[model samples]
Target: MVTAVTDHTDHADHPGDDEGREGSGHARVEDDFVTDRKDVRKKDFDMKDFIKRDTGKKDAGKKDAGKVGVRSESRMFGLVRVEIDDYPEKPASGDDTDGTDGIGNKGRADGAAGADAADAADSGVSWDDGLIARRVSATAEGQARPVKEAVVDSRPPVVTPLAYDGSLRSRLDALRELVGLSRTRLDSRTLAEAGQVLDEATARRRLSGQHTVVAIAGATGSGKSQLFNALAGVAISETGVRRPTTAAPIACSWSDGAASLIDRLGIPGRLRRRPLQSAEAEAQLRGLVLVDLPDHDSAAVQHREQVDRILALVDAVIWVVDPEKYADAVLHERYLRPMAGHAEVTFVVLNQIDRLPGEAADQVLDDLRRLLDEDGIALGEYGEPGATVLSLSALTGDGVPELREVLGHFVAERGAAVRRISADVDAAAARLWPVYANRRQAGLTEEARDEFADRLADAVGATAAGEAAERAWRRNANRACGTPWLRLWRWYQDRREPPTGRLSVRTHADEEATARQRVEQAVRTVAEQAAGGLPTPWAQAVREAAVRGSQGLCEALDELAVRAGAPVGRPPRPGWWPVAVLAQAAMTILQAIGGLWLLGQVVGFMSPNLGVPVLLMVIGIVGGPGVDWACRLAARGPARRYGLEAERRLREAASGCGRARVLDPLASELLRYREVREQYLRVTGVGV
Candidate 1:
């Protein structure tokens, strides 16, 4: 018998479906829905097709049953769950109603069962298909939601390992600052090398923080290549008795993320390898970028050059030596002693110890340590054992684990590059200590500047200008406020010598020539004073800077002398000048009238009015003396005041020229000295 357990309940009418539809409209971003809507429609169509095919099969079974009306009491969610349920035999219409299955069980039951079997065969739907259900969701307005958001498993988050982010940022920042300062200010070639070290370190760190480069440096026949292969646990570098077996540096890294670092070291792609990942013991040595370098003592020039280049960039160095050449003078002179400050990253490997007796090997290692100590190599990390001297034989694999363990520790504990660069910066700072340290904080004192200004003032003829201005001012005053008779007398005398009682500019071609010489001497003296007690080279620099203005000093001074000392027009006439002149005019008019009357009396052209004439004469004569006295009194003070002002104006201009030409340049040198000192203190970490 065909039985269908279908969910006839419309999901659109389900409780909370209205809320779901409303929230879905708002919850899904419009852009996400727009792009994915077509796919959602396709899935919906496929699911609906499955639903229709299922319903058609059931309709055929039911058609056989309306003939046999068969039904079952079972519900499905979103899918039709089909299960055969055996129905009780239906009573014939004329016989018994013993069972109530709602369908007559006469002959239709057999017919419907047969039809259901045929439809099941045609439909080919079975429970074995992994997708046993076609899910349906209701959107707003009775529409189906085709696709549903996938549910993620709720679990604790998996923590990703953190990469190094310059944990020593401040210290490295300080060290880089020191390197930059030393490169610029320190004349010594050592600082340039230190700067190179810093640049390489920072570049490598930035490219990949996880990797620390280790260079296996050795002389001819030192077995460094063999050790490189041994440590990497694979023969990444060829070993031979031939001279300069390694022409270029060969990089063998334990980790996968050091490609950029290897590329920066100039290692070719063909020469790079991940050689130690297979070994469980060596797995802890990740981020160790080991290089087999060309022998430093190679006979080939290019080989030595390659060795020098790689050694400079690597974070740590392992010096490989044999018993036969454990104390080679060339290695000590060229590499070890000079790199003593780098002991934190330096290791002296006494290789080929298998050939020596145990005691003999120990003695050789001890002797190597003593030699390193004498070279001022402080062993260890910041006063701990800096350089590790170990005996390892690559041929026999003796003590290889110890070397590997030490390197692994180094690679694991971060900041080797920072430590190395800091040591180099320290070396650079030490070299510059004498150059910049122990300097005074004093600048050019005010007393010294004033003296320089005074010298400059004399050269520009300031004194002469002032004196001339004083006299010129007095003359101008007299012209405006003096008695008319006295003024006329002075004006007549002016033809011989122009009045000097006003502002005057006195510039001598001869004075300028002499002034130039004085300026040069003064510039030199100021430079010397500013450079006092400084190092010889810096002192010379200061002196040169101060003297640079000397080329144009004389010309500038001459220009200012003509301009500053020249009169700024005549001083405003004192308030009393107009009054005095007016009074003088009146008195002169009275005198003229009185004299004319007397003349008329003498010529007998009119009666001699004796009373009026005598009174006019007396009044005119008395007024003339009084007005003259008043004019003299008023003009004296005005002349003095105007002369002083004119002198001051001229002096001010001359002073400006002197400052620009000489004083300003000298101050620049002083500023330069102060800057160098501060930079030096910062680089050296000096408190002051």
Candidate 2:
């Protein structure tokens, strides 16, 4: 904008750049020099006229001057006009203008000065009112002015786009969630058609948010292709007396943005039409992509297949029917009746209605609607939109406008694709509900879990491990804490057979096989119990999950068995064993010395030591035996306690080993199924 300022003297530079000013939506500062210039020029041109008209009438001239001042003041100070001399009050000596007029040359200069002052005052009057002014004085000052651009300082407000409908977004979100369900549990193959529908909806919307795909479906000789051409207002599809003339799929859109959608439907480029510009009468149908599919009852298998393929992908189906074939079983029984959930996007057009009388046409429509209702179709009325029933003749273009309007309303709402996908998802989810309903609501019982753990424990020879720990503990305690006199006998027994090698017992290969079989049996039992009240398919699924979970468990159990059967570490003994051994040693030495002396005396080779020797021998022998008895008695309690503790530890360890190998996997499978079920419920909007 300021660049223009450089070209024109009046257009001066402003605060913002040209581009910024244009896009800012802001007010620009402007100079109102034109209005002031116009007022001044008018005053100067009328100066002579005013003097001639009121010659010699100085009072009249004075009145005229006063009025001019009032008018000019109004112009300067807004609507409120006031009266006063804008010129420095003309000289009291009557020399205010030149002699040729009413005052001298000095007064004329004074008038010019006063005019400049008035113009300045007028500019600020928008902020504050002017006191007084005169018009004649304004003309003396040439108002060399600039254009005043209004000053705009506020920023634009934030705006949110309303491109996609809220309901459409929510419905698509729901369908997307439904598609995320587990394949193994949901029969993905069975839902393949529904899955294709979901993908087509999202892909089509991504490419073109506007176009509503309306597929023309009917048996041969129904004039479906002609109806499609009539709706398009163009002879796009090859329509004639020939049967199944529309070989591939003939597609025509009313507006742009449907190229990718057409490609996704696998329509060949040759058969596909570039969208025609929207017309005023048919503007509402601008977003509609009408597809003329091959006849459903075509003799050629490929034609029927093409029809089926396009039918599954399109947003809506317009079933074109002749009066004679309107009640055809193949068309309604196989397709319409099975698609009850899709009533919102289904259409039944009784074509050739023009061939019938008014009463006959009405009767045919009523009968057709009745058949549709019997097929579980919810026919849309004038106000309520659902499955619609229309009667028309594509050959004569009768009822085409009404059909166009209907398509327009659907395309305008932009919900046909979403509604179509939502129904598909609902149908698929309904089919998969039974497998997950009960499991989603409740999990496997705690008793079942405990029973499973116990089964695993028994499978891995938990008893053998416990008994091994106990016997090992006892052997260790007795060896470390029993009497020194019995130590020699215990060493001899260990040397003889190694104390039965506690925990490391021999096992037959057949016993291992039997244990493994018992483990598998236990898994089966737990699975059966968990699946008790479920329906057959779900029960079978649970059983399969358990079997899959239990894989490699037998091998893992063998490893656990080897570990459980191994000997446990020895138990710690009391410190009193050492003191007892020392005391016993001393007593034995004393007894030996005393016995030697007594023998010498009895043999008559030494002094008679009867009193001391006999007493020492008796005390040493009796006390040593008594100490052994006391140590043995004390060892019994510690040994039993240590044994019991060892058994408990070993049993717990063995059970844990078996559990990780077998039970954990089984439980995880069940848990996964439950989590998926919960997710499924959430997608269904039944739970948080």
Candidate 3:
């Protein structure tokens, strides 16, 4: 029982009608009369009619679209009830709503019509540029009562930012550090090459990255000059029958802002040129700087040298070969073979293909590929990344477009400079691999250090000094507590021998000389053990460190020996020594009295008792000996403890001196080698 209706208003009355409906694409819903739901009519306005009606009368409203204010009214009268949910446009100043509809909604026709035009003009947004509101909803009158949710359509596209790449810079920095650490330990020649790579990479990065330097090089009479002129679209480089027409390099820039890059190649300003004035046609080659190098096999030595120098500086190279000299041994062996690692930035062109008939060109190309393969250059075909090979004739202009297209793509990528520098780093690292990581690291071992300390202690005579101290202590104890007659007898017996009152710990000159020899030998032995299994250069470095540290070590050891072996005096006496001395004295007196009585009795000067004399003699004999024996037994333990303490002091002093002089320096050198090797591994990306 539902029906639909469409209303059309005259466009001539509203001068700003086009502006009101410019980017708001939905048609206006208006004029609803409430009635019973069974008899309701719902209708959707046709968009084609709305657009056609607007376009047909657009000229009448165009003049005043932004200037004049007009009214647009929509009215509906029916039994069906409809609700209009309109998002009114932002109104201009001094406009208000004046009318209300059946759904209790206020309507303002004049303000609504002029609001879009005023807001668009003020915000500088073109509604015709498709600025549509997000919410456009409507409700239809039907028994089912369908509802549409407010949603947005045709939002602007999102753009993602590119991530920065720092892998190349990081690797180059690591290589530079390794080179710095290896200056004294590694060969000068190998270090110089690594230094050159670092210098080149730094200088190339300082220039504009947008420009790529590509050189055209070949042997004499290869028509490389002709190819260069053809690619440049001008005859700037001299070409003739001369032996070496292009003695120096000539630079051709496709676009501007390449003067600094060309100067970095060492080309003079007079030899620089712009190929074409109009840049839009050669937009793909905007950053290409082409150079024509001298003949590599020229008879003139300087020309060949110039070619070699320029080739090393350029980012990429194109080797043009004629069919006659395509497989020259000098080109393959001297240049191409050595540069096999740089295949990603190389191009091989078979020039003068016009001379070869139909299938001959393809056959020669296949043969060139085979030669390059033998030279260890990968072919950039079948979707592999390698050197690009193609056939072209500079004279006939055959296959020039394909070469130009390939060159343009290569130039646009803007990665030739980075790739070439990275290849150079790889080559340098490969050359230095043997010096950095040929064998397992060897370090100073604990057993070697202990043996070194023991040797030094022996050289200083610590053991002999300890034994002398022990004997000195025991001899002093016997002298302090022995019986008076026995002491006199012992002193008289030692009159012919040297004095034993103090220990003789002083070392002789010959012994000192022998100790010096032992010190040197110990240092050498420890250094060898620490540097065992190391490379020759590192071993030499470790030995040098030990030698440098051992300069005044022998003198230092002599001084330490003197301090540790100082003369030892008598040990402190026990309190029982006095009592023992008094007992010995009393025993001597008793023995003297007994001897006198016996002499008197034997000589008949006085009457004597034999029992008393005999008993006195026996008591004196056993008591003095027993007291001396007890004191000697007590002195043994203290003497041994004192000797051990002296030994420990001397041993520790010798060990400390050896550690400071030899072992520490050797260990530092080994640590330095390990640090440099670690940086080399980082440069090569091993284990990381």
> Which candidate number has the best TM-score?
3
Assess candidate 1 and give its lDDT: 0.62
With a 3 Å backbone cut-off (N, CA, C), the pairs that clash in candidate 3 are: 3-41, 31-75, 31-76, 35-79
The TM-score values for the models, in the order shown, are: 0.57, 0.57, 0.65
Query: Model 1: residues >4 Å from true position, as ranges?
Result: 1-202, 234-236, 273-279, 354-362, 381-385, 393-398, 424-438, 471-507, 530-548, 566-648, 661-688
Question: Model 1, 473: alpha-carbon shift in Å?
Answer: 5.6
lDDT for model 3: 0.71
Quick one: ranking by lDDT, best first?
3, 1, 2
Off by over 4 Å in 3: 1-165, 179-190, 234-241, 276-281, 322-329, 353-385, 391-399, 433-438, 477-490, 499-507, 533-538, 566-568, 571-637
Model 1 TM-score on a 0 to 1 scale: 0.57
**Best candidate according to lDDT:** 3
lDDT per residue (tens digit) for residues 531-614 in model 2: 776545556777887787678877766675566454444456677768766777777877898899899998998988699998
Runs of candidate 2 with Cα error greater than 4 angstroms are: 1-195, 223-226, 229-280, 352-367, 382-385, 392-402, 427-449, 471-510, 523-570, 575-637, 663-688
RMSD of each: 24.7, 23.5, 20.4
Question: What is model 2's C-alpha RMSD?
Answer: 23.5
Candidate 1 lDDT tens digits, 247-334: 7787876655565667777876435654533345446787788888988988889888888887777788999999888788999998
- Residue 33 error for model 3, in Å? 71
Report the lDDT of model 3 for residue 570. Answer: 60
